[model samples]
Target: MSFYSGIDLHSNNHVVVVIDEEDNKVVDKRIDNNLHTTLEVLAP
Candidate 1:
């Protein structure tokens, strides 16, 4: 399986989108604007 990730950075927060090769979204949501939290959320 393959995955594609996109990050929409805004002034207040960030939107994350994780998709597959067929453009099927695996995960989509918004998170707090912070480096540590972002990494933690993305960590596997």
Candidate 2:
């Protein structure tokens, strides 16, 4: 019941993805580079 996340950061935006323990993708998104936006997407 655990999850893992990875992000590919760029100057203007970021590509983020999250996967479960079984390696199934749970979340996939492209978000602004802004810190608040990133945090919101990552929030539980």
Candidate 3:
């Protein structure tokens, strides 16, 4: 299956979302601006 992701970035936090090819949500949450945290949430 294929997946897609998007992020709304701000100064201190970000909202990240991941969806499948079928438009089903895989991950949808807000995370800290830290790269590690963002990557962790984006991980498959």
Candidate 4:
């Protein structure tokens, strides 16, 4: 199965959405704009 990720970027934070092959949402997160924070939000 494959996964897809979409990010809604903002000046101070981001909204991240991850979906599975069937288009079911797996993760929905809002995190700071920092690189480390963004990576942590997307990490498995």
Candidate 5:
């Protein structure tokens, strides 16, 4: 299986989406607007 990721960054927050090889969304989240926090939110 393969996976992909997408992130939408704004001034206040971030929207993250993860999809699989079949193009099905696996994870979706709204997270804090910082590098550490964003990484934490997206970490496996």
Candidate 6:
């Protein structure tokens, strides 16, 4: 299986989305503009 991710960055917060090869959404969230938070969201 393959996965892809996209991030919509903003000034204070950002939107994160993860999808599979079939374009099925795996994870979708809005998180603060912090390194740890971003990493946690992106982690499988």
Clashing pairs in 3: none
| Model 2 poorest 10 in a row by lDDT | 35-44
Cα lDDT of all candidates, in order? 0.87, 0.92, 0.88, 0.90, 0.87, 0.92
Error of 5 at 20 (Å): 0.3
Model 5 worst lDDT window (10 residues): 35-44
Q: What is the C-alpha RMSD of each candidate to the true structure, in Å?
A: 1.2, 0.8, 0.8, 0.9, 1.2, 0.6
Q: Give per-residue CA lDDT, model 6, range 1-44, as digits (tens).
A: 99999999999999999999999999999999999989987877
Off by over 4 Å in 4: none
Candidate 6: what lDDT? 0.92
Top-scoring candidate (TM-score): 6
TM-score of 3: 0.88
TM-score of each model, in listed order: 0.77, 0.88, 0.88, 0.86, 0.77, 0.92
In candidate 1, where is summed lDDT lowest over 10 consecutive residues? 35-44
What TM-score should be assigned to candidate 5?
Answer: 0.77
- Give the Cα error of residue 6 in candidate 1, in Å: 0.7
Distance from true position, residue 24, model 6, in Å? Answer: 0.6
Error of 2 at 21 (Å): 0.5
Deviation (Å) of 43 in candidate 4: 1.9
Using TM-score as the measure, name the better of candidate 3 and candidate 6: 6
lDDT of 2 by residue, 1-44 (tens): 99999999988999999999999988899998898988888897
Q: CA shift at 34, candidate 4, in angstroms?
A: 1.1
Candidate 5 lDDT, 21-43, residue by residue in tens:
99998889888788898788667
Model 2 clashing residue pairs (backbone): none
Q: Is candidate 1 or candidate 6 better by TM-score?
A: 6
- Candidate 1 Cα outliers beyond 4 Å, as residue runs: none
Q: Give a tens-digit lDDT track for model 3, residues 1-44.
A: 89998999988898998999999999989988999888777765
> On a 0 to 1 TM-score scale, where does candidate 2 land against the true structure?
0.88
Better of 1 and 2 by lDDT: 2
